[model samples]
Target: MNPELKLVAARQGGVFSRAQAMAVGYTPEQIRERLTGGRWERIRHGQYAERADLSALDAWEQHIVRHRRAVHAAMNSMRPGSAVVSHHSALVLQGIPVWQVDLAEVQLTRTSGRGEVKAGVRHHQGRLSPADTTRVDGLTTTTIARAVVESAARTSFEAAVVSADAALRRPEVSAEDFRRLLAVTECWPGSPAIRSVLAFAVPLAESAGESRLRVLMRNEGLPPPVLQAAFNDAAGFVGRVDFYFPDHNTVVEFDGLKKYADGSREALIREKLREDRLRALGLEVVRVTWADLLQPARTATHIRQAFDRARRTRLAG
Candidate 1:
């Protein structure tokens, strides 16, 4: 590629438009020849990226890069601030984690007048205050709090909590921010559901998988356990556990099942020692994994049984 074309691609995130190619001294005919010869690939109408194997990148990464290009493709022709990225699109821009979100279209919100409905963009009438919008990477987007609520209002409860918990981890967003988001979206279609998740949301959840397990356990009728409960014995503090049932002397460990695969030998040994300490205290440990989470009822049943066993074991001892 020529110097100018390379510069243009670099500025445009490895993707450029036909107009960019032309400005870089390539004629329309030359662009067509490049496309025909497989030297470039069309990501969207008028949006092209150099033809290179993307097998080195994972599918999710490739998806994000293409989404960014498509978003740029949509924004390249849009008026500044007139089309602000919102909803799930804003979540992505804010670096928030997402699961079970629709990534098929780049969503935009009108900052002023009704935004034009473009072919590849989903436009919403989001008359947001300056406080509710943020600029990320030269792109306008709804604030992280607003984006989290907007997305939560449209997704399943578990998925929304995952997002909400993740958003709460950020210093910019807070519980009050969540309340404000809920208040503003009060009349929205999914407001009640979103509010419920917000009410249940906690910042202490360290992972989406943990948030999800909490939701599952609640929905299945298990008594809500205190989160990150600290344990102590005569020696010293045992450790903080994911969930603790003080009433029944039980501890529920939420494992994503990924930890078992990655934690080194020393980490595994330390974890086992921690469990042994908890068990020595006569606290029955109930482990919940991804598979257990899928069958919430069964998991709840096992937990109840553990609760009973712990109570009986403590009495016997």
Candidate 2:
């Protein structure tokens, strides 16, 4: 590990391109030797990082690596032109939830094409304002807000709603940012549909998990579930519960069955312990599982009964 390469790797947070290494005075052979020695890990064709403490490819990292690859491919495949990664690619990069499936197409906007070009990418060619683009990790990308708008245009009202909600909740993204992005993309191909979906989803994205229980509860006319609610006491901030009704001191937790690895018996014991704590506080607790959520009619009945019981208890006291 030469000082120059170490400095470059540190500056890049242990990720650098072959070109970046060359610029920093490391030969391709040197890079290869380091990789063979287990001193560096190759992330992509040209991207390398430190071998130790490598982060696994979670959902977010998958999106970023895909976006980075697409951008690099686009740069290589196209003529000399600047293209900002747009639409769903931007949404994924911004950590907005659009769907769970793989996006086979990389999206981008440049000035030379009419509709789409390339096999894996859906490219939209049009004039783009400078403000519509920003540099993220040294690659051009649509601003977070524009990506949300573009994503809404490509999906259904429900999907768009989810994207908008996620976008609003993002700390770096704001309504003002969306407004500015909207102003720039309004005259572009999919503006009208984009505008409609953006309006729909941004207000509804309060919860983090995309659980069917959430959808079932919403469809059944329950009040919107507060997301990731935390409990605080003598111990600095107790565990964060899934949903809580502060006014009634009633908590509803959505336990994904898949998370219960040891089996239902152990899960049952854990739930009893959690319930006992809440009961000690004089709080009512309701537990819902994936099965209950799938059966919406039964789920609604359970919720209504719980609400009724809580009301009776409070009134009687």
Which candidate number maximizes lDDT? 1
Query: Each model's C-alpha lDDT?
Result: 0.82, 0.66
Clashes of each: 0, 3
The lDDT of model 1 is: 0.82
The TM-score between candidate 2 and the true structure equals 0.63
Q: 221-290 in candidate 2: lDDT tens per residue?
A: 8777666676665534446677666666677777655567667787778678767766666667778875
Model 2 scores a C-alpha lDDT of 0.66
Off by over 4 Å in 2: 1-68, 94-98, 182-216, 225-241, 245-249, 256-275, 280-283, 287-301
Q: Pick the candidate with the highest TM-score.
A: 1
TM-score, one value per model: 0.87, 0.63
Q: What's the true lDDT of residue 137 in model 2?
A: 51
lDDT tens digits, residues 1-317, model 1? 87888887776557778888888799889889989999988877888888877788878767776677777667665676578888888888778877787676888887666655568788888668777988876778899899888888778899888888988889999878877777788989888888888898888888877898889888987788898989888889999999888898999998766666675888788889999999999889988887887788898999999988987887887
Clash-forming residue pairs, model 2: 161-201, 164-202, 165-201
